[model samples]
Target: MTNTPSNAAREESLDLASIPPLESIPPQLGSPGGSLPAPTVDAGWNTRTKALEVLAILALAYTLFFARAVLLPFTLAVVLALLFRPVVRYLRKRWRVPEYAGAAGALVGTIAMLIVALSLLALPAEDFVRGLPEKLDAASVKLNQEKLFKSFVSMQKKLNGAGDLGVSTETPAPPRREGEDDEEPEGDDPDYAALGAAGPGAAAEVRQAGGVEVEEEDEPATMVVEERPPSLLNRVFSSAPEALGGFALAFVFLYFLLAEGDAILNNTIALLPTMAEKREAVGLTRAAEKGVSRYLMLVSAINAALGVCIGIAMWLVGLPNPVLWGVMAGMLNFIPYVGAFIGAGVVFLVAYLEPDFGLLDAAMAPLCYMCINLLEGNFLTPAVLGKSISLNPLMVLLSLAFWGWIWGPTGAVLAVPLLSMTKIVCDDVESLRPLALLLGPRIEKDDSASDSPDAESEKPAATAAPAVAPAA
Candidate 1:
């Protein structure tokens, strides 16, 4: 190798030069003198950080609760905007309509249609309202006659220590002493005739008892002692202003959202730094919008169909107010799980209150309603919605509970849509993919975990391990 510029010599020299000196090489982690491990803050700091995150979440919840008056309408508007997006688009594309014009027409037409429908239903609804008390009283009487109701009442009475079901529970008058003069209280019942004669005059002093006279002044007979219960008209008028205000605010928000939603979305997407981020933002927004709108529209249609089927069934069974029940079923179906049961219960109660219905016959309407619900929920919904908008049943219930607690019935109605939106967002974001998986109907096992660094590192070692042959 002397004085020879050989390939091996050159290569060896290169290798030697490439190898870093021991002093220059960093110490390995976990070694005694490893480069002072990245300085970690106190564990207390981490605990404090976690506590701050929890407090942030709690504050968010508080804000949502307190701000519901405004937020509820805005949320409703958002959902409605998504739902109406297609209609507005159609109008714009087909007739060259302005976004504002299209939105206005759609919103106005819907309101008008609602007003007309309400007008049509008003007579029957009014009649129903008027007779509701009578019907309820009759139903109560019938219920009391039932063995089960009677048993429940008796059990309740027993629990309250009120003696037998049929026996009077009132306290008996105290037994009079044999020598007692029962009729000696002459001044106890003062003459009201004298009081009426001297209306609003000086206080009247009755006969003295133990040398002390009791004087009583009279109030005007015309003055009311107790207020009459509020009438239906009064109640309706009282609520009208608030209800109307809410509707106005909601519609105003909806109109703007419908008109400017696309522009807002575009602007939002444009603000993202990278092309990827912009694309991701657009995709996420579009997917969320589409998913929510499609789910709501399809569910609405299904509910309408369910309502129709139920109404037809009711009519066939000769039940009163089939249309009302149908509309109620359709409306209530917006609320998942609970809505169906509520509609069914109402139908059952109404059916049972009918004189012609035996207990079995009364059950028919609710059974029919439930059958329709089962078909729609289990078969139709799954098939139509598929997995895109599908959510975990447990998650849905949790959302319902949470949102309901936050905003009451309106929140319950909105829970599924809000959850769907959340799932869409989670699905789009890489970090939140796990949460999306959790929210989805099926939790898929992550096969990608096997592709982790440790596993990958072990793969080569296992492959490179020298094979040992068995010695015979």
Candidate 2:
């Protein structure tokens, strides 16, 4: 029995030796009884590298935040260039215009349109500014009368009392001398007297205490007026030269990009090592351009139409500055969900504050706006954009918040387009396809996977192969 066992062991050892080494064997043949070797994992180094990459990304984001002044205008220009590129190309090809001339013409035409739009809005804007103070005062008074404000005030008073904060709520009555009539205070009406004397170069000697100014001189005095520092808007307008310089730089960049279009593309593609990579890069670039440009153009057209409808509706409803409201609505609509709300809020406020419109009439403004937004969001956008460029609602909101934080309003405006482009690029690149899938909306599995006859037939072969492995 011992000899027999030894003989069996010797035969098994010979059989094992006859087989090739796992490394030397063809992978397909070796897989019959053995699993493929697991790939080596470097837990420490990989974690370190991942951390460094994250740090680098954070550092880049920091740099972008600080550099936004230069970057914002450039980004705007790129978007504009993309928008106008097709027109420029058409002018060059159809009209036989030189590239430089076509670029200049496109740029000038855009500027002229902007100037015309601004000119149309100037009077309305001026009127709005002139009446703003009164409107604000009225709004403040109205707000104070609201139950919410009253409750807030009461809560604050209770808190103050509990803390013994020494807050006062007293109003002292004016002293009345014997035989002095309350009606004999004509000169004490500062506003009436001030209005009567109000004109250019009119001045009064005033003593200011606790934000209240008391006029000492009733007569019109030569006012040595002290110039107040410029406001935020004023400061921005005052830096027009810097703005213009940035615009000029952007225009220059746009011109070159439009002019040397093929050369730029060729140079970019040439940087890649393999022909396949170059082709892929070119394809991705074209796809991104097509998708982004088409989206922008379609959205612009839709917004323009919405603006016209808003203008007509406001006009029919007897709203003041209908054109102004329309333009604002159209412009703000570019910002997605937030934009529509902002535009509606402005309309609601204006309507509510208007002296001519009653509460019912004022309510119509928001109602109309809401209806328009409903139609646009539910019907128009989906029908127009279709499935190709559709993005997840959560992704859209997140992109909006991210870009809004990074680049402010401009960033918010560009967020969807940029996100769409990023998704497209990710979808095209093999390694990034997973990210693209993640960004995309969820898709339900098809019945074909389970119902296919081929799949059913293959199940037995698949199970048999595994079962046969152990026996082999």
Instruction: Looking at model 2, report the run of 10 residues with the lowest lDDT sum.
Output: 200-209
TM-scores for every candidate against the unseen true structure: 0.70, 0.67
Tens-digit per-residue lDDT, 1-472, candidate 2: 7699999999999999998875555567676777766666877998999999999999988987889878877777777777887877789889999777888888888789988988989999899879988977876777677686899999999988898967679998988769765442245465436534643223232222233355887878687989899996798789878768877787777877777776888998899999998988888877767767787899899999889998888888777899999998888888888888988888888987776665567779988887898898889887887656557778888999988999877689888777877777776678987888777842223535656788799978998998899999
* Distance from true location, Cα of 410 in model 1, Å: 1.5
Scored by CA lDDT, what does every candidate get? 0.81, 0.79
